[model samples]
Target: MRIVDVCAFYTPHGGGVRTYVEQKLRIGPQLGHEIVILAPGDEDGVVERGPNARIVTLKSPRFPLDRKYGYFASAEQLHGALDALAPDFVEATSPWRSAGLVADWAGAAPRSLVMHADPLSAFAYRWFGQVFSRRTIDWQFSVYWEHLRRHSRRFDHVVCANSDLSRRLAEGGVPRTVTLPMGVEPGRFSPLNRDPALRARLLAACDLPESASLLLGCGRLSPEKRWPMVIDAVNAAGQQSPIGLVMFGEGRERRTILKHIAGNPHVRLFEPERDRETFARILASPDGLIHGCEAETYCMAAAEARASGTPVIVPDGGGAADHAGDGAGMTYAACDPAAAARAIATVLRSPRRQPQEARTITQHFAELFALYEDTRARVRMAA
Candidate 1:
């Protein structure tokens, strides 16, 4: 089958969505499918060419907030690209402008709407947290809900990477919602990858001795990620014993995170590790991975942490909690810094979970590919 993914959130310097798309490109061919991606770029043309997979860049304008990202302007160009690809199936991976365009597509192949992020919790709560109650913010988010609810009807399937988002969309009246968890490369990140030297260096960077409990935080340093809350929790936990935190990742919250961790020798912010093996070793070395986001869809960071045999500390809701798994880590009340601190202390006091082998990426690929086939078959039968 030939599958085309229209992703507005993919860029050379983007986050999880970019990684997900790239991973799909690598796996699609192994599953005997051709995968093409249509993404926004400064230059309009095919940048990556391969027999089974390729990325087609559509000329678009730079996003004002961050020039690293591009915004789609002409829907006609997108439609033209889709028409040319003539894929067996189409998947719209973002809820922004591209989604509406893909939903209204009058094409031969079936379409699927992949919900990669939650707009209400990721954006609204982060944007209006100071001005309105969550209930009020959620009420305002209904506008977005209605937008998706209407567009989702046009697609053959609505797919979510976690059950939380799937249940929310299903409850909100979106049809054919499905939960499909993403997978991690267990070989890249395992307990055996743990490096005592790297752990020592990380501890030293945070100005802590080897005796101090080292907590690792990974992901975008954005407001929705709630890194500040994690920093506060670490500081609170520091009062009890020697605890240090090293956060990896960059985002709009860099300055804010720096300010939050200022004057605390035990907390430091570091740029994301580019080397995969080194990063996995870092994950394996940490006493635990602490996550603050409650609106997470499928936290690849937490999943990778678990794959590295590192225990995770996450909020009690959202995808992170689901990835933490029973006996894999600890969970605190959602968005509660105090509770998170206690959870951190508990994890440090308790013996670490024995590193277990993680399911391979092939498993996730097979499951998602089956969904595509099933959707296509159902569409043909209905036709």
Candidate 2:
């Protein structure tokens, strides 16, 4: 079947969604299917990934919040692309206007809302989480919940990349929520990718020796990431022992991160690694990763670390915590830097253990595509 993904969340320097779509492009053809991406870009064009996969870009203006991303303003162009492509299955990753567009599209193809983002956690809860309870936050964002419910009722299925997100959606009145957790590329990321020289260099920047514990933090440098909290936790943990944190990410909050890490020698922020090999090497070289974002739908960084035989410390809830199982890693209370510091110290004191099982992107997409086929079959039968 030919599948077209209408993605408004995709960006050139995106963290997880970009990685996922790229992986899907290769995996789809391997499964004897065609995959196409329709996204907003600075210009309109088509870029072929392979014989069965390609990206169709629609000319759009830069998104106001971040210049790295673009927003689709013209529905005519989007619908025109969908009409020309004529996909057998349509999937939308964004829960905003893009999902609404897909829902209202006059197409025969069975549509799926592959819920990749959690706006409630990413925005509302992140903003007021420290002040208001989650229950209160949810009540305040009733409009978004209703919006999701309306769009969900029109879709064949609502696929969530994490069980936590699926459960949340199901409870929030979105029907047909399926828990299909995403995965990493095991072949590309592994303990074998660890580079001793790289590790030493990063530690040296912190003015620390090889014996010091080197932690990593990654993702888009954004408000939702709560990077300032992570830096505080790392700083607190550093009080007792020599520890260094090397963060990889870039975004509008770069200056905030810089200010937070000012006068601190143990924490350093670096640009995200675009090269897969170099990224894997940098990821595996660290003793562990400390992620402050509790709102991740699927913490790809944690999963990649797990696949790399590196431990991870994540917030006590959400997908990141789920991925950081006992053998995989550990967790601390969300938004609690003191607790995070303790968790960091505890991880440093404990032994490192490789994850019992490493999940692969290939395995994940195989199941996802099979589900797509089944959903299409069911839709046809119902018709």
Q: Report the number of clashing residue pairs per model.
A: 0, 0
Best by lDDT, which number?
2
Question: How far does residue 97 in candidate 2 sit from its true spot (Å)?
Answer: 0.7
Residues 1-383, candidate 2: write the lDDT tens digits. Answer: 99999988888766678888898899999999999999999889899998999998999998897787787788888888999999999998899888888998899999999878888888888888879998999898888888899999999889887888888888888999988888888578888888999999999998899999899999989898999999999989989998999999998899999999996888888888889899999888998899998788889999888888888899976789887776677899988999999999988888878566677888888898899999899889988
TM-score of each: 0.95, 0.95
Runs off by more than 4 Å, candidate 2: none
Give the Cα error of residue 332 in candidate 2, in Å. Answer: 0.8
Off by over 4 Å in 1: 127-135
In model 2, state the lDDT of residue 76: 80
lDDT of 1 by residue, 55-146 (tens): 99999999898888887788888888889889999999888789999977778898888888887777777678778997787677778878
| Each model's Cα RMSD | 1.7, 1.7
Query: Which residue pairs clash within candidate 2?
Result: none
Q: What is the lDDT, from 0 to 100, of the residue 113 in candidate 1? A: 88
